[model samples]
Target: MKIGLFGGSFNPVHNGHIKIAEFAYKTLGLDKIYFIPTAISPFKKKNQVAADNDRINMLNLALENFNYNSEVSLFEIKRGGVSYTFETIRYFKKKFPNDELFFIMGSDLLPKFHKWEYVEEMTQSCQFVVYKRSKNINKINAKKYGIKIMNNPIFDESSTKVRQGQLALVDVKVNNYIGNNFLYAKEIIHSLLTAKRAKHCVAAAEFAVLLAKSIKYDAKKAYYAGLFHDICKELDENESRAFISQFVENAYDRKLFPNYKLHQLAGALWFKHIYMNDDEEIYNAIKIHTSLALELSTLDKILYIADKICDGRAFAGVQKLRQLALENFDECFKQVVQRNIDYNLAKNITFSDEQNEINNKWSK
Candidate 1:
């Protein structure tokens, strides 16, 4: 019997893992494939993975619809220590002495394969089948290590990106699993904001979705951008200023605004660092939520308008602005910008360079 042993931290297996497994199964003619989830990877940082059971369950959920022969093994998880590939391979070799064993991995790991424990013994025990991970130059020579490269499709999906709320890239089951478990809920957004502010965030998310759908933007992205837009609204002024000073450009200009008004930029940096969210649309929307820009994308405008018209807001003329937002976003945004400028002028509030630039360009 021919068997393929695929192992990883699998932190939470995404579609990329599934694609690689299928490619290995077909190209290598393996009789069965075993997915070995590690309790602790020697190569990865300690406590970086999800709980062992949670990782296993997610792997099970991901493989439920798999057509090829596959099974998940908890041998490493049961071992209760740092998982070494050589130990697992030795155990499998003893069990399947007469069977041929192949180790499957991505090409990116090829460079580090030499650093693994007992590489010579493991290579003698089984052949390695590697698939491409990316177009980056391979630092290690595969021929020197006797590794076979398999022709497989490139998978750009990442588990880290999925955990950051890029749900569209993963399988529906995976998305549902994350949502049901509240795995990626932005805790900072909930913890930092008061109950009233949290309620406002929820309302803003709903309105963002409405505006996004009307304008053909991604509703989910809009929702998250809105939800986290006020994350730093209640943070200590010193902390907010510190974060803005470090991550946000034009920090000195931003300091001109009142602390309450600086949360938009602070919140954007906070989400980027905490959630590992690099989506420009979401980041820009959060950054400019309190201060509408002269030029805005559909998502930017949606979040700006949603923050003002969310049901939790009780300002005068909010109802009319809400109606106008759904009817014509450009017109509604112009009104919002003008209203803010008028209010600021009345209070003699100084504007930042970016704010003044927008007002000068659009306040006609």
Candidate 2:
């Protein structure tokens, strides 16, 4: 039978992983698939992993209700060492010598495949199926390695971005998917009636939504993520961490970058505390809005950058970023980020790697 092998840390699975898997099932006419999450990965530092059981549970939570035949493989967990794709492929090869096994991975990873451990052995053993990351991005030259690419795929929705606290304005599909059915705009209205801190949340929410819209983001999620951004800042660190712990169970997504007292994280928790349940997208946008910049989702950038550029805030160079917000979005984004970097440079404050990457990508 033809099958695909999808493996990753799945520190916490995000919508993109599920979307790609679904795409594979529909287009590839696969018979079945195995999601083999590594017990540990050696490529990077050991991520701050939740228990293997917890990781598995979150995946199970994420994978529910798919029509395709699928099963979570436990081989990596059973072996219990730094997980390598080559090693896993070897095991699968031995188990299914005659079966057609396609390995699914992203375009970004394909460039580095040749550098992998026993790369020749792995590539020769199985056919490679690749997917485009963003509509704007394209891959070339990698096809020489026997790679077949998937077209018109969504990029930027990555687990790495999720962990680092980057949030965006969620769109309607995401809003409806939440199951609660309340959009961020409605959530803001509700939070106002309930919380005393809700007053400032309006301005915060406005700034976030405006920024997201300026950047062409989903306005609804941006509004709510912004509205709830500062709802938890008044809480103590222990309370904040507790809130984060309660809300963001995606361990890998949580650790790709550092977590500071970013409002997105707090806002997400406040959503659950007041609302009883959450849309996964909103919860994540809140969870990671500080660091990971992937997807640049509407609420993510709006809440992070808008907190500074909005009209009411009195700060140095406020006129520049604010003035440029509508006129030239990219310039406005770069200026806001440049000001932050210049400010840090003056004080010699250690800049986050994320902040650094932001400066580089936008300013460049």
Candidate topping TM-score: 1
Steric clash count of candidate 2: 18
Cα error of candidate 2 at position 27, Å: 1.9
TM-score of each: 0.54, 0.49
Instruction: Give me candidate 1's TM-score against the actual structure.
Output: 0.54
The lDDT of each candidate is: 0.80, 0.65
Q: Candidate 2, which ten residues in sequence have the lowest lDDT sum?
A: 166-175
What's the lDDT for candidate 1? 0.80
- Cα lDDT tens digits, model 2, 43-139, are 6454565457756765676667667889889999899988888888999899999898888877767666777788778879987788788554334
Which pairs of residues have clashing backbones in candidate 1? Answer: none
